[model samples]
Target: MDAFICAGMMIIGRGISRGCIGARTTCLPGWAGVASSRRRNRHRVESSARRPFGKRLERFGVEQGMALIKDEAVVLRRLDFSESSQVLAVFTRAHGQQRVIAKGVKRATRQRASVGIDLLERGDIVFSQRPGGEERLSPLTEWRQLDHYPHLRADLARYYAGLYAGEAVAMLTEAHDPHVGLFDGLRKYLADLSSDEPGLLLARFLWLLLTEIGLQPELSVCTSCRRLVTEDRVLYFSSRSGGAICRDCEPASIEKFQLSVGATKITRGGPTDARGVRAALTMLDYHITEILGRPLRAARSMHATVVKSVSGGG
Candidate 1:
């Protein structure tokens, strides 16, 4: 009789474990019911573990995961990481600035020699990153070169101008912040560098970049006193005060430099002559240097190249 009762209890427990007991049916008494409930929970955990990682996260209400992104980009800087890899700072049109590591990009095979990435090269790029990992370097999966701007390499002046532009973009723009207009302007500037005069092209580009980033100084009014500045007035530019200053306001500014009427007019979108353009670039570069807290490494060399070109022309 005891054996018969134990067999019946075992069968009931198995039925309960399989969820065969409906709401209308009575649950097993005490420890048998508890054991069945524990088995169900364990089974659920094992089932969950079998699902994909992304789905498992979704079950807990987490939606973000590793994502792959594609965009058009220009290489601003490149650093060799290993014999077969490189770290690149690339400015993308839609995605803004990104620091990514290109693995095996420099690896040599029987097929092709490893040339690696070059600064100022434009290309389409595909990279992978995790959500909330913007501060970390992304992994670059693929790259297809589009434009080498061959003219930039042929002329030393154009090459330095390109370098200066790359440095400015890298230093001034924020990571992951999109500047579509600025990107277009940069592309145009690079394209025009071969035929256009480097100095004038660089000046226009710097002005556009400054305007895009909201760093362009106040040109028409005194930044200190908010007074209207006229063409004849003795004008001073103070990067610290945020723009042009009148004579009276200039004394109050600790950091300032006198500006020529032509340079001032050119900076405000007026007509640009060759002499005025050079002066404009000088003033703009001054402001850029002040903002960066140091001089651009390429600035001196680029200026020298421009001056030499001009002197040779004369």
Candidate 2:
């Protein structure tokens, strides 16, 4: 009887040991499950945090053949395609100047809502850089509307000035040279000129634009004899070598245009009054016409003429 009881006690202990081992094996998977759930929960929270900017980007998504990119651009000009899409010349803050095509953008519904922006309009844009191509004028994928310079379109003089502005940008900048600051200066100049004084504004604009682009004569000094341009002589402007040559040196280079002594004193980035400005402008216009090889007919017609009051010549 004693032996039987001892054997039973040993068997019961062994069974209890086996049961405990089995219970632990089963609960281990549950522990692993809890750990995995914790890891997944952490991942879920991180993923949730990442969603907004992604949604912002999706709203900003641009379609290319196999990729998408983000960019900010201002509309410089746009051309209508046969009818369905538009080709745009945009100055992207990121990519300088680019010629992009907004595919299927011209339909009445406008897959992209706005038919590329009107000239000189500002906007947020997205476009693709193709797999194989030079960065110059990267193919435009699309233009998302952000803002418009309605004043540029609504007013007549502003429209023409806007065109001249476009000419300035195209002429002065290469396709991919980023000039954010110069453009900001141009934009402010445009906005002021559009609303304030269109007449006097254009002249000042030409002077500013030419000087900014490094096309005008270095008003720093007379190009000829390297003398400080004094305020006393009639000035002759040169388009050939590109600045004023004091009269003494005028005979040497191919003669270009004449500026009154007073005009020479008005340096680049300097001030001028109506009379001084007009004389200076006439000389500047002559230089521009000569250098461009033909007349900027628009500029010619835009001249501020002193009207001989219907009765007689002034």
Candidate 3:
């Protein structure tokens, strides 16, 4: 009889566990809902448990197990998740772009050891990846800031440029696809934003970004005729055609931007000219906008920076 009773209890207990996992409020006649004793209002836990299995698992960070992932990352953006937690979008040197949950990060008594989770900040982070988890949001366990880039925040134009670069990386690059070269290049670009020729640097970085993404414009040859784009005369850049075009191949129906010989020469790493930089900026702006299907918010700021640089030089 004792063995029979124990077997019945075991069966009943498993039924309750399955009911809880399934997120049902009631489980048959004799079973009570699982409740959290720590909370004054038990409805919170009860209601939370009533959600779908996937959602409940994500909320509790429960899964098969945790896999440790340690990498150097550059902070891209952060969103407030709960009262005490934050969701961070970061570009890791080894893991590319990812979303991480920083729990208790906003608490006043939280421990901090050189981990600044601010936009455009670089940091070394330790996180835990949940196997067979919902939403795939990893939990950030530790962070040690590498670079704060205080100079960028001090200057508005520089800050906007940095924002642009970070946004581009977050938007263009695929998540979890490691691009260490692009990550390193962005770090160097941010460090050099305070240089004397920032516009030129930005233009060059934009060109590099295009090249890294395999969307490099054909500056050496015409896109249509495949003929060499000689530096003898003026050139026409067509967004629709994807690159420079000769006069014969240039479509009259499609609008194209005229590029002076100096501008064309600069694309091939010639000496930098203000006109060349501006022209390069224009062409890249068009190309990127075409590919992205939307204009970059920093384009206006970039144009303003160019005007200021030109006027300041004069």
Per-model lDDT:
0.73, 0.53, 0.65
> Using lDDT as the measure, which candidate wins?
1
Query: For candidate 2, lDDT tens digit of each residue in 1-314?
Result: 00000111122223222223221111111112112232446564345335553332232222233244456666766788646556778776656788776544444321113333466766566565545553533434334445556676676656666665566566556776776666666667667754565534555666666766677676556787887666676567788877877778888877666775445544644334555555655666676777677656456434523211111223
| lDDT tens digits by residue: candidate 3, 1-314 | 00000111222324333223231121111112333232454675467557654444343343335666789888888788876667999999997888888765554321112222588888777676776552578877556666878888787767877887777777778878888888888889889976646667677777777778888778888888888888685678877677898878776628577766555654665337776666666677777777788987777786676525632333
Winner on lDDT (1 vs 3): 1
Candidate 3 Cα RMSD after full superposition onto the native fold (Å): 12.7
lDDT of 1 by residue, 228-311 (tens): 888788899989888899999788788999986556765656335666666676788899999999988888987787634542
Q: Worst ten-residue run, lDDT, model 3?
A: 1-10
TM for candidate 1 is 0.76
Task: Show model 1 residue runs off by greater than 4 Å.
Answer: 1-64, 268-271, 307-314
lDDT of 1: 0.73
Ten-residue region with minimum lDDT total, candidate 1:
1-10
Best by TM-score: 1
TM-score of each: 0.76, 0.65, 0.72
